[model samples]
Target: MKVADFHYERPDSLAKALVLLSRDDADVQALAGGQSLMPMMNFRLAQPDTLVDLNALEELRGIREAANHIEIGAMTRYAMLEASDLVRKHIPLFSIALPHIAHSAIRNRGTIGGSAALADPAAEMPALLIALNATITAVSTSGERKIAAKDFFLGLYETALDEGELIKSISVPKALIENRFGFYELTRRHGDYAMAGVAIAAQHMAPLTGLRIVFFGVSDRPLDVTAIAETLEGQSATDTDIVEAACRAIGNQSLHGDLNADAATKTHLAQVVLRRALRGMNA
Candidate 1:
C-alpha cells in the first residue's frame, strides 16, 4: 500500500506550525525527521489529511547545558546528541545508548522528539529519558507545559501529549558526581531493535543508595521497576543473589514477544540483559 493523498504545508515558524496544527477540520501530523513516520505512511499504518513539516523551526534543535539540567531540543538528531560535548558531559547515559539506536544513517536522520513522540516500546530514547528522570517540554497554542518522562509514555505508540501539542525539548538533570549508570540491550544484530533492554541509574554503591531501572522491548511501554529496584537498597547480596532477586521481581509483568521469541523467552532474555546492566555499571 502507498501513503494516501495528503495536503502538505511547510510553516516557516513555530507559531505558523501551531496555527496550522490547530485546524480541527483536518487530521494533521507533524513531520520532523520522518524515520518512523515515513515508514508508517508507506505501510498505510498512518494516513493523515495534512502533513505539517517542522524542519524549518530552528527553535527545536541543539543541546545546551542550562543551570543544573541539560536542555535538548526535540529536533536534535541522535548523531547530533552523540557529537555534542554538552550531552556527553551532562548526560553520559545518552551517549551510552546512542550506539544502539539503529545504524549511523538512522541516527543522522532520527530526531529525539520524533523518537519520543513515536513512543515505540522497543526504542531506546523513551526508556533512557525515564531512567534519567528527564522532563519533556510540550508546546501548544495555549502555552507550554512540562511533563515528567515517567508520566509522558502512556502505552505503545501513545503519549501524554494533548491534541495539537508537540514535544519541544527535553530536560535531564546534569549527572552528579555520585551518580552511576548501567545500560544493556540484547538484539539479533548490532543495530536491530532490542529484544530486551534495560537502562539503570543509581545514586552510589557500597550500600547502594538509590536505583531506577527501566526496561524496554519486553513490554508495551517502557516499564519502570522502581518498586522492584527499591528492594536493592541496603541489601548485602552477591551478584548471583542480586540477579535472582531482580528476576523474581519480574513476577507477572505481562511481557510481549515478537515472531522471534515467545513471552517466556523474552522474560528470560530480560533477566539476562538486566543482570548484565547491573553488573556493568559506570558513572
Candidate 2:
C-alpha cells in the first residue's frame, strides 16, 4: 500500500526541525532514516499530516568522545556503529549487538535514535542502553533535557519525549577494563525482530559494584532486573549461580507473549538468554 498524502519539510538545522515539530496546527512526525516511519506510513499505521525530515540536520550525525562519555548523534546509522572504532572502544556492547540488529540493507538505513525513539519492545538499542546506563538527550524550543535510559522508555511505542521534542544524541560512559558485557537475542531469522533478548553489563570491581540485566521483547518495555543483579552481587557468578539468579529474577514477573510464543515460552526463553548473557561475561 502507498502512504497517504502528507506535507513534507526538510529542515536544514535542528532549530528549524524543532520549530517545525512544535507547530500545533498539524500532526507532525520526525523522520530520521525512514526505515520504520516509511513502512508505518505506507501501511497507514501512522498517518501524519506532515513529516519533518531530519536528514539535513548535520548537527545530529557523528560520534565524539567527551570528557568521560562517548556522544553518538541521533542520526548515526547502524552501519556506522558496526564499523566505528570509537564505538567498539567506548561501548563494546554496540559492537557485539549491532550485527544482530537486522540485515545489511536495514542496518544501512536504520538510525540509533529512530530505534530508541520508536521504543519497539523487540528492538535491541533500548535494552542495550538500559544495560549500559546511558542517557538520551532530547531538544525542543523550550530547552534541552537528558533522560536516563531507564526512564526514557515509558511503554510500547511510548517514551518520555514530550511532544515536539527530538532526540539529539545518546551518551554512554567510556567502557572500563573491569566491565564485562553480554548480549543475546532469539529470532527465527537473522534479520527478524527478536522474540526475546537479554543484555548484561557487569562491573567486577572490589566494592560497590554490580550488574545491570535488561530484557526486551518479553515485556511492554525493556525490563531491568536490578533485583536479579542484587541477588548475584558479590557471588562467584558460576553457572549454577547465574541459572539460579535467572530463575529467581524472572520467575515472579508476568511476561507477555504473542502468536510467536506463549507467555510461559517467552519467560523460559528469557531465562535461557539471561543465563547465556551472564556466562558471556566470563567469555
Candidate 3:
C-alpha cells in the first residue's frame, strides 16, 4: 500500500524543522533516514499530515568528540557508525551491536536517532545506550533538554520527547581503561529483530564498580536490572555470582511474549544472554 497524501517540507535548519513541527493544525512528523517512518507510512500505520524532512539539516549530521563524551548527531546513519573509528574506540558496544541491526541495505539508511526516538523494544540501540548510561539531547521551540537514557524511553514507541521537540544528538561517555563492555542478541536470522538481547557495561576496578545490565526484546522498554546491578557492584563477580544475579534479575520481572516465543521462553533467553554478557566482561 502507498502512503496517503501529505505535505512535505524539507527544512534546511533544525530551527526551521522545529518551527514546522510546532504547527498544531496538522500531524507533523520529522523524517530522518526514513527507514522506519517510511515503512509505517506505507503500511498506513502512521498517517502524518506533514513531514518535516531533516535530511538537509547539516547541524544534525556528524560524529564528534565532546569534552568527555562522544556526540553523535541525530542524523548519523548506522553504516557511518559501523565504520567509524571513533565509535569503535570510544563506544565499542555500538560497534558490536551495529552489525546485528538488519542488513547493510537497511543500515545505509537507518539513523541512530530514529531508532532511539522510535524506542522499539526490540531495537539494539536503545538498550546499548541505556547500558552505556548515555544522554539524549532534544531541541524544541521552547528550549533544549538533556534526558538520561533511563528516563528517555517511556514505553514502546513512546519517549520523553514533547510534541514539538526533535532529537538533536546522543552523548555517550568515553570508555575508561577499566571499563568493559559486552553485547549479545538471539535472532532467528542474522538481520531479523532479536528474540532476546543484553548489553552490559561494567568497570572492573579492585571490585566491579559500575555495573549496568540492560535487557531488550523482552520488555516494553529496555529493562535495567538496578537491584541486580547493586548486588554485583563492589564485589568480585564469580561465575556462580553472575549466574545467580542473572536469575534474580529476570526471574521476577514480567517479560513480553510474541508469536515467536512465549514469555517463559523469552525469560529463559534473557537469562542466557545476560550470562554470556557477564562472562564476556571477564574475557
Candidate 4:
C-alpha cells in the first residue's frame, strides 16, 4: 500500500521544525534520512499527519571530537561512518557492526539517529550503544535532555523519547588502551537481520574487569545480561565451566520468536553468540 497522505514541512531552521513538531492538534513526526520512516509509512506502520523534514538542519549533520568522547550528529549517515577515521580508530567494534546493518544503499540513506529512534529490537546500533555506554541527546520546544543508552530503549520499536522531542546526537566515550571488544552475529545471509548477535566489551586482559555483554535480536530490547557479566567478573578467558553455567542463564530468560526462528532457536543462537563473542575477547 502507498503511504497515507501527509503534510510535509521542510523547515530551514531547527526552531521552525520544533515549532511544527510541537503542534498538538495533529500527529507530527520528524524525518531524517527517511530510510526507515518511509518504508514504515508505506506499510501503514506509521501514519503521521505532518512530517518535519530536518535534512536542511546544519546543526544535526557532523561528527565532532571531544576530549573524552566522540559526538556524532543525528543526521550522520552510515556510509560516512564507515569511512570515518575517528570511528574506526575509537570504536573499532562499531566498524564490525556497521557492515552488517544492511546493504550499501540502505547504509547510504539510513541515519544513526533514525536507527536509534526507530529502536528496532534487531538493529545493531541500539545494542552497540548500550555496550559502549553511550548517551543520546534529545531536543524539543521545552528543552534538551540527555539519556543513557541503557535507559533510552523502553521496548520493541519503542524508546524513552517524549512527544515532540527529536534525537539531536549521540555521545560515545573513547576506548582506552586497555579496552577490548568483540562483536558477533548470525544472519541467514550477509545483510539479513541476525537471528542472534552479541557485542562484548572488556576493560583489560588478565582480569577481564568491566565486562559488558549486550545481545540483540533475542528479546524485546537489547539484553545487557548484567547477571552474566557479574558472574564473569575477574574470570579469565579459559574458564569454560563457569562460562557454560553463565550461558545456561540465557535459556531461562523470556524470548520472542520471529517468522523463521522460534524462541528456543533464538535462545540457542544467543547462547552461541555469547560464547563466540567471549572466546574472541583477548582476556
Show how many residue pairs clash in every candidate, following the order shown. Answer: 0, 0, 0, 0
Q: What is the C-alpha lDDT of each candidate?
A: 0.88, 0.89, 0.88, 0.86
lDDT of 3 by residue, 1-283 (tens): 9999999999878888999999988899999888889999999999999999988988998899987899999999999998899999998888888999999999998899999999999999999989899999999999999999989989989999999999999999999888888888999999889999998888763477787888999989998885676777788767577668877878888898988999999999988887777677677
Residue 121 miss distance in model 2 (angstroms):
0.2
Over all chains combined, what TM-score does candidate 2 have? Answer: 0.96
Worst window of 10 by summed lDDT in candidate 4: 237-246
The local lDDT score (0 to 100) that residue 113 gets in candidate 4 is 95
- Give the alpha carbon lDDT tens digit for every residue of 119-223 in model 4: 989989999999998999999999999999999999989999988899999999999989988888999999888889988777765666787778899888998
- Deviating ranges (above 4 Å) for candidate 1: 236-238
**Greater-TM-score candidate between 1 and 2:** 2
- lDDT per residue (tens digit) for residues 49-147 in model 2: 999999888899999999889999999999999889999898999999999998999999899999999999989999999999999999999999999
Candidate 2 clashing pairs, residues 3+ apart or interchain = none
